[model samples]
Target: MADIQALRGVRFNRRVAGPVGPLLAPPYDVAAEFTDGGEFGIRNIEASDLGAGSGNHALAARRYQAWLKNDVIRADPKPAIYIHRHRFLLQGVPVERTGIIARVRLADWSERVVLPHERTTTGPREERLHRLRAVEANLSPLYLLFRDPTGEIRDLMAAVDANPELDDHDQMGGAHRLTAASHVTIHDRLASLVAERTLFVADGHHRYEAALIHRDECRNTRTADRDSPSEFVLALLAAVEDPGVIVRPTHRLVTGGAANTPDAIMRMLRRWFDLRPADVTTLAVDTDLVGRVVLPRRLGTWDIFAQRGRPHLELLPLDRGPAWLSLGVTAIEGAVNRVFSADSEEVAQHLFPVVEEANAVRDVEAGRAAAAFLLPAPTLDRLLAVAEEGDLLPPKSTWFDPKAPAGLVISDLRL
Candidate 1:
């Protein structure tokens, strides 16, 4: 069973911190790419101190202490479950996603209470663990999904009538509103609703693993108690049936491979997939198809009329099981492996995942990449089924849009 509890969340003091917009940042994995005027706009918690050096961890810890000392950020007076409503635009369509931010007891994989679908690498897991040890806090919330067919949880969330404590937009123009629900009755009911259902990790697999390791380490050191803060991780829980919970497809780019020439790659792909010519201008491949390949144009950019003759390959598998072919990312991985005669490790080195189709196309047209493999987004039901069956998907298979920004609510594990 899953144990969820309200947390005494740590938040920024807008009066002292100036504004919440510049202090917020994306998760740590992509925070390196974000810059505000050559540096983070302010000495924010998660984005400012992610340097590649070993001393970066200590720097983050020092900055966190300084913020607390200067009243830039402070902890709540009482424990409460935070109601977060994240509103953003997806493909020009407005979306509002709501979830509860709470502390969840960490469970080992063998327990099977909380399940993860995507595979994680060791490098990221270790890096997160090191940062956790130095900071002793959860700077970001893990995105989790649960089954709520009865809509009971949604109704409960809607009942929260307290005024929002933080209502503002981030640098990406996403609107975030946070309210604290401190009613003991509501917390008990919310806990009961999720107690019977299994929790699925929609994102933050590496950070989850790091939290588990940190808990075990604390136990070994005899510093943890029965209700130690280290035993739980901060997470944002949402229902799988929520319409705002959207998953986008991640396209793959091939930078360096043995099949460097377009002809060589085409011949190899033809052996396993039936390819059809597609319009280069609007190469929106059918979702029912297995995959699509965009090779580098020989002469001009994709916008030019002369480039319209470029061959855009639409791939359909010749023979494959429905169970295996249903996963678009898995199918693409298999085709890439077979085409290049490479194993999973070799493919990881040359093949990179990109969330935008335009970026993938540009990389190929600009001669930076050999080819781009565009895939269809996987359904939520399919992903959940794989997790329930104890199966794992490829890395970066699902991109959950409008991610919950870091520093909205921090979980301090000092106790």
Candidate 2:
């Protein structure tokens, strides 16, 4: 069963930090920019210091201690789950995504209580483990998506949203409102709603695995009267039915087009996709073409942008590839993996992931990268089906937006 418990969250005090927005760091994995110290800057989180929130784990802990000493952050006197609401605009439409930040007990992926959508690399997991060992805190919460068929949990979150304890407005025009749902009755209801069902890890694959590693290491080395907080990781769980749940695409930018011309790449790509020229001088003119289009419309169709050409709309035969390979993300990854290498692998060597298509296009058009493969965000149905089948799409497959903010509510592992 899924145990989504409340915890003594360590958070920055508004009185000391001025605004939570400035203090908030984008989830360690998806940080776009680092603010040093200004009207827009963060204080001591050292976001850029470590790629994934803790570059120097000891230094990170020291920063935490210093902040605590200076009254910048204080631990909640009582245990509570944070009801969170993020309001954002995507594709020129307003949306409000609601979720809860709570301490979810570590459940192995094999247990089916908690699930992982994508596979993870080893190096990132190792780095996260080192950081967790040095600083006994969760810098950010993992993003999890669960099914609430009857809307009970969604209603509970809505009731709590009426009176938020903290309202943080970020520079991106998104508002993050947090409320502590500590009442015993409400907590029990939420626990019941989220219990015994599979909750998918939308993000934070590395952190979750790192937590498992820490728990295993602790179980062997430590002695404690009660279960340790290391047994759980900070997580924000959103209902699959929530209106605010938006998944954005992570466009892939490949390097070295100069050496391997677009014609050459396209030639290799034709083995899998039926490539045809797409008419558009600019990527922005028909943003939806790239933003809305999903491949295998009839066959293997994907709009692609590469060096010095109009671009191509690709289609693959429905009967040609495996049924699982029909997924747009999977097909694209497979094509890239096949097309861009000598051994028909090593896509990572040529690939750079991007959150924005403009940036992806700029990098390609400006000669910064060999080509850019823009993608549409995978549908909720696609993600669930893939996870249910116990298959991973690819690394950097989904960019769940707005990326969960860090430092909004820190989970103290000691608790």
Model number with the top lDDT: 1
- Across 26-106, the per-residue lDDT of candidate 1 in tens digits comes to 777766555651233333446534564678788888888888898887899989999988888887989888899999999
lDDT of 2: 0.70
TM-score of every candidate relative to the true structure: 0.89, 0.85
Model 1 weakest 10-residue run by lDDT: 302-311
Overall lDDT per candidate, in order of appearance:
0.78, 0.70
Model 2, position 185, has a per-residue lDDT of 82
| Count: clashes, candidate 1 | 0
* Candidate 1 local lDDT, residue 75: 93
Per-residue error (Å), model 1, residue 81 = 0.7
For candidate 2, list the clashing residue pairs, or say none.
50-55, 300-315, 300-316, 301-314, 301-315
